[model samples]
Target: MWGSAGIVKPGLERINRLLSFLGHPQRNYLSIQITGTNGKGSTAVLLHNLLNAGGFRPGLFTSPHLVSPEERIRVSGRVYPGQLEKEVRDLGKRFLRRHPSFRKDPPTFFELVTGLALKHFSEEGVEVAVLETGLGGRLDAVTASEPRIVVLTTVSLDHQEFLGANLEEILLEKVAPDRGGCLVAGEVPQYLIRLILMRKRKVGGDLFTTGRDLFVWRNGKGSFDFSVRGEIIEGVSPVKGTGFQAGNALLALAAFSCVAGSVSGKRGERLLKVLEETVIPGRFEVVPGHTTVVLDVGHNLEAVKAFCREAGKLECRGRRVLVFSLMKNRDPLSLLRTWGEVADDIIYVELGEMFHPFRRIREVSSLLGVKVLVAKSLRDALSRGKKIAGSGGCVMVVGSHYLVGEYYRLEGKTADI
Candidate 1:
């Protein structure tokens, strides 16, 4: 499923069927469902950590694994063991035996994995689950979980082919699972917040929005304070310290404050500790060496723009080199132009079979205003980037999660972040 270049059917029919067969294990625990273009994984991880600090025994499920699928499903910040993984597979086999219709028409890979996560969470006696939607919330498999807390991170122009052509249309599809649950929205435009309230009135829930109900102010470099629900928690910091990550942390903290009621005393201390220690892999993850290397999986225009902003903050003695490749579905013109402003040179490489054509990138290469070079492979790209960056500069590998996974595989490193 990770390697396959196929799209799943857009609806809850298949996942609903699977959940019904499994006796709806999702209802056994409180769930927090997250959906967005960029910050879904980070928010999920943050909320999961907060819930774990509250003694919820939380299970987390996120998509586009960096190196392995095991990174997707976790219990109490640890991957579900291999033995239980086999047990879930056996249970899936039993489901196949019980339902003959599924033989002719099988559920998608994401559906099967979501079912596995839900069932495993139930069997492991998890009290809460944090689920990040694999795609749009209306049709994604995770929506069948019917989460109690719905978190919408910054929704940008991503997966437009499946979600919608415009922002309003995509917003509706992404907010479909909010069935009278506590909805926490990130820093979106005021008009969209009004649209959200208009759509959510049918299924009522108290909406806590950033910049209105929730606010954050910088306390120091890489540290800030969150003011939510008329309470202010001070001296909180996020991993990587990017402006976008602080926004992501604000969304997570807002949702956590909504669920836990108060972010103070022992609970507040535990949550703050979790935030300080949490490290999300492939989100501006820096590996120190003679030439510092940074890995990020920001492919879309909005996400890439955030990455470029963060990259500009890094102090480099030499030139900053960008190592990048994108999926075929993305338009590289805007992303290349954005990267060109921050990076001194760009090395384009093939993302195995999923590589986007170089001709489109070449057509706009002149407009980038930076040197763009093609490499034989990801390894070659990284090597050339390091050489170009020299010993005193930085080499940033960004664009897609597939590229980061390839790097981890080559280095024999586990992406347990």
Candidate 2:
């Protein structure tokens, strides 16, 4: 069903056909659909945690698992049991046997996984499920669930080739799943906000936005306070990424308020307590040791800019070294320049066969027009970064999630960091 590893086919026909044949398990429970350029995964995860804390069984479906494929479909932040996998696989076989035509044209990887998650959520009796789109919103497989509430995180230029060239076009593609429940958005340009408002009006949906409907501010210690319609929840999030994460947390809170009622007083405090302890892997994850190492999956320009901003806020005693790699299609020069602005030294490495056909390290170094270190492997890159960082220095691994996963696998470390 997959033509290439990263190629995206945006439509609903394939997934709809498959789900229809599978008894429409997505219809059994309520859903919240999240889609945007970035922070969708974090928002889904945070929302899952909050809902689970509030005594609800919420299933979460996200993409690009850090370690295991089972990470894509989680119940209460844990992978589903082996029986679910067996059930899904057996169901798929039965479906193909009943409809021989499907054997020739099977569902795509993401579509199959999404179907499995929906079935698992239904069988497990989850009250609600959080679905993060694999690609743009309009035709993503998650849209097949027809979510009641939709949250649009920070929208920026990332998948331009598939989505659009400009913000307006991209917004149009991402906002197509809006079916008029509650549309919660992060801080975006006024024009994009107007477009969202227009969509809300068309769908007859309520709109809540950061700095307007909902407000979040970070304190000196990096903990955040969330305010919505005069009700303030103090010390909401302790997740230390960029300031953008505060906005993501607010989006999650706003979404929770939409489905589960307003968050205030004791309930708000409980949610904050859960948020205070939540740590999303590969999003500014800091590993403590003799030399500090940071792992982040900030691939796009906006995400990388946020990473740079957060890196500048670190209280490092020595130089800030960056270890980076990117897929072949990504714009490396722009990301490299953004990292160069905050990093004292940069090391480029080959991600090997897993992320093969990657951009050559020498070509990237040549484009930067600077003396950048090139490593043969991720382990070598980490070693070189630590040496360059010296004592009390900081080393940052960024650009792509694949790079971070490779590092974890090579170092025999868990992706749960």
Q: Which segments of model 2 are wrong by more than 4 Å? A: 1-7, 83-93, 219-222, 240-244, 353-360
Backbone clashes in each candidate structure, one number apiece? 0, 0
- Summarize candidate 2's per-residue lDDT along 1-417 as a digit string, tens digits: 233325566789878988898799989999999989989998998899989988889999988877666778888777866654455566667667777777776566677778889988999998989999899899899999989889989789878888999999989888788888878888889889988888788888788887788888776675677887667888655564445467778888888998788688778888887777778888888787778988899888988888888888877887889988877777777877788998889888777554423346556667787567778788888888898898889999988877888877876876441
What does candidate 1's lDDT look like per residue over 42-149, in tens digits?
899888888888767889998878887778899998886765445546655666778867766666667778898998899999988899998889888999998888
Local distance difference test values of all predictions, in order: 0.82, 0.81
lDDT at residue 53 of model 1 (Cα atoms): 84
Overall local distance difference test of candidate 1: 0.82
Per-model TM against the reference:
0.94, 0.93
Give the TM-score comparing model 1 with the true structure, all chains together: 0.94
Which candidate number would show the highest lDDT if scored against the true structure?
A: 1
**Candidate 2 least-lDDT 10 residues:** 352-361
Backbone clash total, candidate 1: 0
